[model samples]
Target: MPTPSKISVVTERGQVSIPAQLRKELSLEKGQQLLWEKTGEHEIRVTVLPERKPRGAMAMLGFAKRFRQTRRTEDWMAELREGEK
Candidate 1:
């Protein structure tokens, strides 16, 4: 995949405007949170993350629990051993 060459956003009252092309490509929507990092002089990185749902971590734990409940421990152990080869 080709990375975007250059992008610019206007700074207003200490807030920056994210470009529409980058926003759409990253699936960003209004009121979404973004993470920013400074790499070096005149360089910065921005990334868009999916919106987090309430109790999302609990839901993931539940998924793991249900999956483990349906699997035999011995079978899982065997698979793990095979993966070590």
Candidate 2:
């Protein structure tokens, strides 16, 4: 079965809303980016880019296995502070 076409109007600022049904089906979220490309004279392609994983603490999960720590937390902090003097 062919899916019915959806129509959207470009606003004065050139913004177009994606239909609710399609947004839900695609799992689109706010702040997500879309890639637009010109395919032909009258056609364009829009692709949903994969969401990027957050950096910092969340990105460091399970990273401890790669490097072993030999000193205690307090010892390490004290050593770092000693360098300031």
Clashing pairs in 1: none
Task: Tell me the TM-score of each prediction against the true structure.
Answer: 0.52, 0.61
> What are the runs in model 2 whose C-alpha is more than 4 Å off?
55-85
**lDDT for 50 (candidate 2):** 98
Write out the backbone clash pairs for model 2: none
- The deviation in Å at residue 59 for candidate 1 is 9.7
Error of 2 at 54 (Å): 3.6
Model 2 poorest ten-residue lDDT run:
1-10
Question: Which numbered prediction scores highest in TM-score against the true structure?
Answer: 2
Q: How many times do residue backbones clash in model 1? A: 0
Candidate 1 residue lDDT tens string, 1-85: 8657655665666678776777777778788988899999988887776788768566565575655557688999999999999
Model 2, span 1-85: residue lDDT tens: 5456799899999999999988888899999999999999988889999999979999999888789878899999999999999
